[model samples]
Target: MSIPTGTVTFLFTDIEGSTRMWERRREAMQEALKRHDTILRLTIESHRGYVFKTVGDAFCAAFTTATDALESAVEIQRKIDKTDWGEAPIRIRMGMHTGTAEERDGDYFGRAVNRVARLQSAGHGGQVLVSSSTQELLADNLPEHIVLKDLGSRRLKDLDRPEHIYQAQIGGKEEQFPQLKTLDIRPNNLPVQVTSFIGREKEIDEIHRLLNAARLLTINCPGGIGKTRISLHATTELLDIFHDGVWFIDLVPVSGKDGMWQAVAGALSIRSETGIPLDNTVIDRLKNKELLLILDNCEQLVLEAAETAGALLAGCPDIKILATSREALSIPGETVYQIQPLSVPSAAEETQGEKSCAAGISEYESVRLFIDRALQIRQTFVVTNENAPALAQICRWLDGIPLAIELAASRVKMFSLKELYERLGDRFEALNRGLRTAPPRQQTLRALIDWSYDLLDEEERELFMKLSVFTGGWALKAAEVICGSTAPLPVTAPPAWRDFIDPDHNYTYKTEGSIATYNDIKPDLDVIGLLERLVDKSLVIANQTDGSTRFVMLETVRQYGEQKLNDSGKSRETLKRHLHYFLLFVENYMTQVEDVTQNIWDTPIREEYPNIQTALKISLTEKEYYEYGVRIISSLFTYWQYHGSEMEARVWLEQFYPFPDYIQDPLTRTWITLMFGWILSSTLD
Candidate 1:
């Protein structure tokens, strides 16, 4: 008999109505069981997820991340649901608990596992229940949009105390977030589970479709939306696509750019001359082979990544790049797809009554993801009349972001649907407060972004603030004119000292001043260096690389940078300088865009699109720039529509309309009218 080696979280899933299904359609039921077994094993292996045994309709598995364990359970169910078994449908109820269990050389043994197995008996068909600890550990790393329905504390068999359980409700259909793993980013392959994936079916299908057509493709999405999960899933699917072998390059662990190249080179077992850069060596080796390359987490080091990817794309037509990022690398002929959140049941489907709930929205992937994840942890979980509205409200409150949903799901052990609803009502606040000691920035999603802001140096921080003045995406030249004219003052130095002399006693004193005092500061400004520092510190994410280095400001970082600008009492001047900068850049950007017009672009805007939009929106609405707003809009008409900036453009036009006639030129008036007409026409339908 084999003994289980390490302590693990046990997940036992039992198929409900198995006997009836077998009796009704023995042949179909057998086929369904075969499919179920395949999926259960495949999901476990995907996350390096582990399974102990399979007994008839029940499966015993384990995972390291409760989120992953929960996610694996959900994925298994989803696969089962999609399987065609002729007439025998299989619904499973899963129960999981995180605790130390002895893996006695293959056969597992422990009270934690035993308690969880016992809990399975209490579960109704298609439900999931988990211990409180499991919920807490996996909370932060979960996708942002899925909401967990807390079953609250429940008395279970063979346990002296009440166990807290949660059921997940995946909502916010069409919303997707980049799912974050542990921030350590070390190269260690820590065991994890594929907890839940919201949306991305279309993107996944498209990717697989392209897999047959092209050898390399990159999948990009914003942070905290399940990019790693999707990449891993794609790798699993591509196992068949690539008969040679499938491999993954976890870039998060490699500390430097060269290290990344070294990792890939080693993984592919490529040899090169002692002095040659590993990147070149690796490219040379891969140039002649067909391989599937899944580059996980490349948003932070886009330039290095782009260099490597471009080389590979050029040298090796057979190699494919499946990358996950908050932004995309605008390589020529590269296809960019945006992954969204799971769909929520429409309000019409949510009945209003004392026990009113939303049901029958199972067709939506968001709901399916939620119910499927919930059923993996709770024995009696359901999305019926009693909890539908609360569930729906939770999804909406989370902005339908998938990572947010998974985090909320982990809190299920602590609160009920109604209580969870109330807690989420203060999500902005709740998510910010750290329940335990963690990286101060990881306390909440907002704090994570805020932490990035706090790390920027004076100049980088200032540039971030000024850049926010842009209404939409701007060209590199625009950024250069706006932010490059004056370099940001360095935030740190060993106290620059100036020599002073006193003639009376031949005594000397040293005086120090801010970087602002240095005349050469502007001349010595290193924008690229500053950007590299910002990216390294995670204050800003370096996105794509073609000619311009694209980047993004986290919403939290934007807010914090704005606050810094305000506190410094430089808001007015900074805003003025920012406006001037854009004005200057617009002239140059127009030259670049003259051929394409405002509407047609074959590639995505630079990663700095969000920051630019934030800057522009603030200029028009929050800043006291009535006349300047119209001028800014007139300057960047092409940018407004180029970035899908419909709402912001409309608002700018509205703000421009009230300004005196002198401020609104014919170009501004015509653009505003056309934009307004577009908004009205689009909304009427």
Candidate 2:
């Protein structure tokens, strides 16, 4: 028969121990080859298949349908298993996939063809494997007595997407196979995943393309976006491109330049010369090695990572780097790919019935990930129609973030899905699950944000906490107006406490081990400069809308900042300032609303409404800011009445009916903002 072309099933077969067979039994192998060729050629043709190509002892065949291809594979395996070749017995491994093919020069070729070959390479002797694409076609149809068993998703070399494989098991055959040799086919230090990777096939392909195009590819994502997992998955699929093995260098512990190069050296196990610098030694060792190096957690040491990557590329021509960071290193010749949160099903999808809900979740990445991870924690966990809505809402509440989803999923052991859904209203505390094997920063939701928070300078951290006063997002001008606080300069230059106990300057070292203490005079801060650094570090997200920029912190991030503000004893002052800022903002906007030239206040109020509402809440509730809240509510009283808010201002007004108290404490504000012993890490430590 002529070769099967479009929409055909391709089969690839190889001998498991062909090389050893040829070396050990040269005389008997010639006879064994006759039987091998006869079995493959005859069995494949009998199943209405076409033999397109043959390389060495490996046979490549095609069939019009997956059933025909699978039948051919099963029959061939059984025949080989039963054959009595005595001393030169051969074991054949087969792989198959169904896809459209492109035939040229009397031979079929395409991605499907390449995929089948890799599928076969991942199997063992006397085994047959089928891709999900093929397995779907053979859903109920079986090949004789063959039974199919799922092998899960496996990364195949040269394939951008990982393949979901099903193994064909025959009865009466002791069916034990070693780990399917996919990523392990190459030498790499990638971590062994404990759970099946859930989604991000498109992202993995994009990352692979970016790596192929750029020598240095930095994956920039916020904390807990699964950038490292995606990078590792993508890197595993492209191991064939690297000659020397791929290496993973974790930069979490590498804070300085020396630690950076040494981390690289440690990853590559490069030996250093006595007189040569470690950086030079690392560069020299990798100068001629063709490898892929994954630098994980570069955000903690962004500068050092940039410098190390730059120096290595400047010296090593054949080395490539893949880095994951919360921020990008703006170095030349670097390609940055920002990873977004996984997809979540829309609210509309959740409204449908259970059948539709399951379909909806399967179509989205975030829900699938949550389900996959939840299974590990509680095997009996299954999403039912009654609870499916809650599950979908949980993903939405977490904003489709993978880390947050995983953390929430881990709580399946303790709480039901509905109970877990209720807790998401305060996700920072609810989803603070920790994995002991993870880095300290990755142990909890707060710790992850704290990593970025600690990296900020004092002013940046201060501004970050102050900016949390607003909700949704804030404008630059708004942040400056509400959050900016400049330090007061002293009339006389008083040496900081560190100077008082210094032996060289003060000669005040009273005795040995006396333990000198010192306090610092914090430098003046500018809002504009600190905001830039905060955005660069990924603690704050900046977006340009209608030629104007808006800055935002993630929900959990904003919560952490709020917690920090509360702990610092600055919440009252900050809330009063927030109250005062929005009070004036509304009073000015009311003038615009009164203008017949402008239609409605909706345009200005729609985006900033949340912030104003937050400010109003603080004003109404706080004893000191009662009048500020009264003014804000009074200004919007007519609008709220006209729009007919479900809960009228009257109801909310009743909650704060009692006259609030006021304690004016400008002295306490100034007193707490100074050099106190609260900051304990200084001078004599």
How does model 1 score by TM-score?
Answer: 0.44
Give the runs in model 1 whose Cα sits over 4 Å from its true position: 1-199, 269-276, 345-356, 360-363, 367-384, 433-443, 447-685
- Give the runs in model 2 whose Cα sits over 4 Å from its true position: 1-69, 72-181, 346-358, 486-524, 594-602, 641-651, 654-685
Following a full C-alpha superposition, what root-mean-square deviation does model 1 have from the true structure? 20.1
Estimate the TM-score of every prediction. 0.44, 0.67
lDDT (0 to 1) per candidate: 0.58, 0.75
Model 1, range 302-346, lDDT digits (tens) per residue? 667777777778987777877665445657756655555556555
Q: Residue 511 in model 2: shift from native, Å?
A: 70
- Poorest lDDT segment (10 consecutive residues) of candidate 2: 509-518
Ten-residue stretch with the least lDDT total in model 1 = 177-186
Superposition TM-score, candidate 2 onto the true structure: 0.67
lDDT by residue (tens digit), candidate 2, 381-499: 77766677788888877878888888888999999999999988888778676777777888888888888888877888889998888899998777776677432212111111111
Best model number under lDDT: 2
